[model samples]
Target: MTAQAYCPDPWTPTAGENARTSALVDRFVELEAQVARARAEQATLLVSLAEIAVEQGRRSGSESEYDFATRSIAAELGAAARIPEGTIRGRMADAVTLVTGFPATFAALQEGRISEPHTRVIVAAGERLDDDSRVEFEGIVVSRAEGVTVGQLRSFARAVAEKIDPVPLTVRQAEAMALRGAWVSPLEHGMAEHRMIGPAATIYAIHDRLTQAATKLKATARAAGEPDPRTLDHIRADVLADLTLTGTPTAGDGLDAIHATIQVTIPVDTITGIGDDAAFLTGYGPIDPDTARRLAGNAATWVRVWQHRDTGALLTVDSYTPTAAQRRFLTARDEHCRFPGCRQPARRCDTDHTIPHSHDGPTTVTNLAHLCQAHHRLKHHSPWRMRQGPDGEIEWTSPTGRTYAHKPTPMVRFDAEAEVLMPDLHLSDEPPPF
Candidate 1:
């Protein structure tokens, strides 16, 4: 056998691994086709699931009962499919749109003529309208979706959405104002992404200022005969960071009052050296407990919120009153707009009465929820229905009769003894926990 030392057939370059650009392009084309087919199959499955959900709702008498059943089933579906719960909800929404509202788009998807992303663009473009308008809109756009690239299709879709929007211009302007805010999301390598959405004029003004400052910094470096080490983009980023952190254009040069309020919610045990669980950063998600400690220690004001131990649900804070306290509690509780998939932060949103005050709905926490101005108006004007569950969960029923549930993110609960002793323990005394 050793003497025979047999060799297998000489290996060939797999699809795109070789140096040929044409081979790589061909391989990509094939892959895209495969992906389209897979997406089509997934859509088919989702359509079936949507039909089942509708049927189940019809069978169930109460909306609450239907919601409970559907959510439980959704959890099961998410688990079996190995998808996140949020993703499953999004898929369900898309399925409803494809199967019911945009049958032509659905057919295109089934034939693998368009991918899921194209379908999403189509669906989102027509989302503000009822099924009839969507059908008409899809008829106009579906063919273009098949022909044009995704980016081009998106531009077309935006035009369509703008043309078909039923909201009056004055009302739309108000909604736009309410939607203006900033948010942060964690990124790879301990970096983060910060996004601010505002009026075009306001954003443009800010951008112009940043650009001017960046140019000046670069020019200053050149005049000093020092290397302009930073790119325009890098300089702009640094300038923005310096402006935000130090309340001045440059760090450590001239100090201005820090007027921004940053809220950090952390577990007591984490700061007490008992545990290392992540802490909550308002307008952001989890951060290192050490970072939380630093923020709290440096902050001029800190509010302690006691949460439930087992479920990590927030209980109450002692500092608030019946009126002001309720508002603060609602802000902490909701954290964001109660509408499904809407991430507009609670502080920026209007506290809406689930049942209108005119209808004798009390101004109690049970009757109130945070809704961005757009969604707030949408809820009031459209066929969309909202109700608060006994447990303070918000359930939204779409015009198509689909029900969605939104729950607040749970807070980490600390012990009563820890809460009592927290005021005595100074956050700055310990070394950096990192």
Candidate 2:
């Protein structure tokens, strides 16, 4: 029976294996199509809900009521789905635009030929165009979306939209200039992010200047045989800080005197060198104990905060004054806006009375919470209601009767430590150089 020995090519797939692979590929494609269809259906439903809300509000006989109705519906849906109301509101707006403004693109998504991202890009690109021009823009971009990646489609759609726009470029540029501004956000590992939005040319020029400065500094270090551990990115960031902090601005008014302010909450044991608990950077999250010590060392005054041993809620500060200490306590307890998913820094927020003072609410810590201006107005105008719970938790009840609880951020913990390598810069009893 050893007459014939069978051999199979290792590189080749058997018929059975080939059939299984084909089936797998087919299943993957089918799943992708299913997802696209699901997204399309969701968009349609959101649009329908918005329309219903608007119609219901129309009976109330005011535009303000109509707006409130839309927001109320969004908040209800957001609470039920565990999503941020602001995010859901934005999505509802996008859904309306997608279905009404760009029907062809929506149809493409419905047919499983394009994705949600593709529809978004197309809608955003053609948003400023007239109805006729938008239709023309969609006719071209929808076909391109099916073939190209989302990024490519975005670029193409932008170029096409610009060409088709009825408004002059100069007019758009002037309007866009009003929106130019800078903002900061906290990042992971005890770092903060700065973003500036301006004219494309001006932003690029500023970046180019930073790059040139960084390049020169690196070359000088290399020439001097200095072991410069910093990368170009690091040097560029440092140069940006240095120029902004030390270099005089062209208008040079009181800007130089305006120093950045941040509140840091350090544990007593951490400061006494008996513990390594992470310090909370107030608006930001946790920073290492060593950096906290350095910041504390440079401070002219320190307010010691007392916390409950069982719960980490802020009890009071060391101040004897009632109002000032209460303000400090509230700021420390509510690190940011108490509204669910709102992170507007507490320093910039208004201390809102959970129960109106007119209704006999006392001016105490439990009756007060920090809310950004927008959310504060939303609380008063919309059907949303909130009540403070134990340990600084805020329970928000949406119009549809769903509740969401947002707990106060902890001030002291050993976890969430971000290891940041300190740059070699001169530190003194003054505002931070960068």
For 330-398, candidate 2 gives per-residue lDDT tens digits of 666665688876766576567776765545545556667888777776676656677886556778765
Give one digit per residue, the lDDT tens place, for model 1 in 191-256: 999999975434533554566576667766777798588898997788788878876876322223
After superposition, the stretches of candidate 1 with alpha carbons farther than 4 Å from their true spots are 1-19, 183-194, 204-233, 243-434
Clashing pairs in 1: none
Error of 2 at 107 (Å): 1.0
Query: Whose lDDT is greatest here?
Result: 2
Candidate 1 overall lDDT versus native: 0.61
As for candidate 2, its clashing pairs are none
